[model samples]
Target chain A: MTPTITAFETSPDRGQGLARDMRVRWSLEEVRQPYEVRLVSFAAMKEPAHLARHPFGQIPTYEEGELVLFESGAIVLHIAQRHAGLLPDDANARARAVAWMFAAVNTIEPPILDLQNAKFQEGDKPWAAERMPLVLDRIRQRAGQLSERLDDADWLDGAFSAGDLMMIGVLRRLRPSGLLDEYPNLAAYVARGEARPAFKRAFDAQLAVFTSRQPAAG
Target chain B: MTPTITAFETSPDRGQGLARDMRVRWSLEEVRQPYEVRLVSFAAMKEPAHLARHPFGQIPTYEEGELVLFESGAIVLHIAQRHAGLLPDDANARARAVAWMFAAVNTIEPPILDLQNAKFQEGDKPWAAERMPLVLDRIRQRAGQLSERLDDADWLDGAFSAGDLMMIGVLRRLRPSGLLDEYPNLAAYVARGEARPAFKRAFDAQLAVFTSRQPAAG
Candidate 1:
């Protein structure tokens, strides 16, 4: 069964592939699995139908027959588990890959998301300017450690598993912040992930949605 | 060989079980698995040893033979995958449970952490008072949706899985915030989790460490 995942009918990022559905799409592409997309309007996403599929009423929900899942990390892992390409055959390596997936979302992504909240959510707030540095510092702290660990490696772990996929997605969010450039290797790391054929395909797919829906210029 | 995990030498939460190690401990107790603990000081966590085990320098790094893993969610899922208690036997149900784990950490915990950052990390900022309500409201938004889904259900899913374990852990952080009271059902759900015997065992274990290390009052 071709799993159906949801994306924003009109992505706030304007199809930058930052919407989480891009993660699931990238994972599916890595595994060479075909899937379908169900574009959801913001209002419809909050409605009962989408909420039932995702309690938090967010997009990038995966539904295949009876199995419905959300959270890009989980959806990516599910795809990785079912298909061999995204994880290692060795049990220990596979478990480590899963650990990196958790670290990406839990430890790494939280601070990056805070940076976003400081800008998008609290940009007008009086503290945005003052707290922005603190938030950015938090991201810098994690990036420094991650860069030290990566140390010219091609991937976070031994191979390009789901861990790299999620980490790269989180790092992509930092592209606009310019902090990623401060850590040269980490910036290169994001570049390597972006260069993958699978990533390019997924990026184009989501970008097309935004482009095709562009309002005609006056 | 028994798996070894790490914890803070003296937890800042003062045995409140807010530390990530508590999650790993609870999972072990639920699965009846015996494990060893390695206490790392704040400085030691940054040293080469612990950093080798956990790149991010956090507690709750699991080591058994050659397989080392970090991230409480990943550790819990690893325990669940290897042991019988924490995941469902059905594949679809298991996938759903994993998704809930991600939601708890990714979706639910982020807002709660924002509240913490506002208080613990940025409490003295000039805009702290004004911006706290915004952070609090963000948490309430998620709590409202979660409460509706869990209206009458015992757990997020059908049975007690790692999903509930993680969600409960994230919610426990909110007890001091008092915002949990706004959602009565969600509060009760957290209470139900606390009342579990495994949770009690885990709590006591961490609390004992804090109690033993308490500095004598003058």
Candidate 2:
């Protein structure tokens, strides 16, 4: 069965592939799984039907037969577990790959998310200006540690597993902040991930959604 | 062979079971797995040895034979996968449980962690007092949504799984904030988790570490 995943009817990022649905789409492409996408509007996402699918009422929910899963990390892991090419065969390597997945979302992404909250959510607040440095510094600290660990490694660990997929996805969000450029290797790592054929296919698929919704150019 | 995990030489929370180690310990206890603890001081956690085990240099790192893992969510999931008690036998249920684990750390915990950063990290800043409500409200939004979904249910989903374990661990951090109390059901849900015998054992064990280090009364 071809799994169906939800994405924004109109992505806030305007098809920048920064919204989490990109992660699920990229993972499916990597695993060579041809799936369907269901675009949901902001209001519809909060409706009872969507809320039942995702308690948080967010997009990128995965539904296959009786299974319904949310959280891009979980959905991506689900795809990786059921298919090949996303995780390594060795048990230890697989476990490490998963560790990196959790690190990407739980460890690295939180600070990045904070940067967003500071900029968009609290940009008007009086404290936003002064607090911006603190938030950026936090991201710098994690990115620096990650850069040190990567230390010219192609991926986080032995092959380009789901860990790298998720880590690169998270790091891509930092491009606008310009902090990623500070770590040359980490920036290149994101570039490498984006260069993958699977990533390009997924990126184009989501971008098409936004492009199609735009009014025709005069 | 018994696996070894790391904890703080002196927990900042003083054994309130707030540190990530408690999650691993509680999961191990739930699975009836005997394990050893390796305590690391703040200084030691940043050293090369600990950094090797955990690139981010944080506790608790799980070392079982040849496999080493970090991220409490990953460690707990590892224990859940290897042991019988923590994950549901059904594959779909198991995936949902894993989703909850991600939700706990990613969705729920980020705001809670932000509250911490606002209070402790920038508590001395001039805008700390004014900026506090925004941080608290973010947590409340998630807590409210969670409470609505949980309703009167005993757990997030069917029978207690690693999902509940991780969600409960994350919610426990909100207790001091009082935001959790706004949703009485969520608060009681956490109480249900604490009432578990395994939770008690885990809590007591971590607490013992802190108490043992206290100065003797004259």
Candidate 3:
């Protein structure tokens, strides 16, 4: 059975692949799992009907038969567990991989998200200029720790898994600030993720949505 | 070997279990694991030595022999995996439980954390009042989704596991906003978590720090 996931009808990021749904799409692609997307508009998302699937009126809620799930990390973990490639078979390694996944969201993504909130949401505020540095510093701290750990390693723990997939998604949000380039290795890591054939498929899929929304380019 | 975790010498939260370390402490207590705490001053946290352990200068880093880890979610997860109580033996159920942990931090906590940022970090800004509702609405959306699904379920999945523990922790932050009260079921759910003996132990441990910090009454 093909699982269905919700996404933005017209994403705020356009075709940038920074939308949360892109991670779910890329995860499905990575595991070679065929799936369907149910795009939701801003209004539809806030409605009780859509909220039933995702309490938060957000995109990328996954449903398979009776099993409904939200949160891209949770959905990706579920997919990784049900399928083969995204998690290690060894118990300890698997735990470590999952740890990396948690780290990606909790430790790393918080500041990046804060940066977004500061800019788009609070950019015009009196404290925006002063508060921006604190948020950026927080992000840089995480990036430095991550880069130090990654050093020359290909992946955070071992082979590429959902952890790398999530880390790339989180780090890619930093592209707008151009802060990711300050750490050469982390920038390369995002590039490597974008270079993945699965990621390419996922990116193209999202881009198609934006292109489809255009007035037929006549 | 007993594990060692870090905590704030003088927490900004005045020992209300709002510190990240409290999450780790709660997880350890829940699993019946014995651990030690090394309190670091704010200045020490930014020092090279502490930065090596935690680049973000955050509390609650786990050091179990050679396996040193930062990030409360990851540390809590590590303890949960090593100990028996926090996760289930069943494969599918275990995956679902782990998924909740991700949901707690990645999905639920983002808006709550943003609210904190807006109030404490950017409160003086002119746009703070205008932007606050949007963030709160975002939080309410997630709370509403979770509250409906939780309906009458005792826990997120089957029995209480790391997922619920993490979820409860995330939800508890909403108490200050009185938003959880807006959703009766979620309020009850958090109360259930607070009622746990393990949670009490962790809470008291943190509370003790605040009490000890007070000067003796003359």
For TM-score, candidate 2 versus 3, the one ahead is 2
Candidate 1 chain B has its poorest 10 consecutive residues by lDDT at: B112-121
Clashing pairs in 2: none
lDDT of 3 by residue, A81-157 (tens): 88999998876567667767777898788778778877987788776786678889878878998898788877877
**What value of lDDT does candidate 1 attain over all alpha carbons?**
0.92
Q: Give lDDT tens digits, candidate 3, residues B74-94.
A: 777778878899999976577
CA error at residue A217 for candidate 1, angstroms: 4.9
Which candidate number has the best TM-score? 2
How many clashes would you count in candidate 2?
0
Task: Please list the residue runs of candidate 3 whose C-alpha ends up more than 4 Å from where it truly belongs after superposition.
Answer: A47-49, A89-92, A122-138, B88-93, B124-138, B152-154, B176-184
Q: RMSD of model 1, in Å?
A: 1.1
DockQ of each: 0.86, 0.90, 0.44
Candidate 2, residues B129-152: lDDT per residue as tens digits? 998988898998888889989999
TM-score of model number 2 = 0.99
What is the C-alpha lDDT profile of model 1 across B1-218, one tens digit per residue?
79999999988998899999999999999999999998999999999999999999989899999999999999999999999989999999999999989999998899898898889889998998999888999899999999999999899889999999999999999999999999999999999999999999999999989999988889
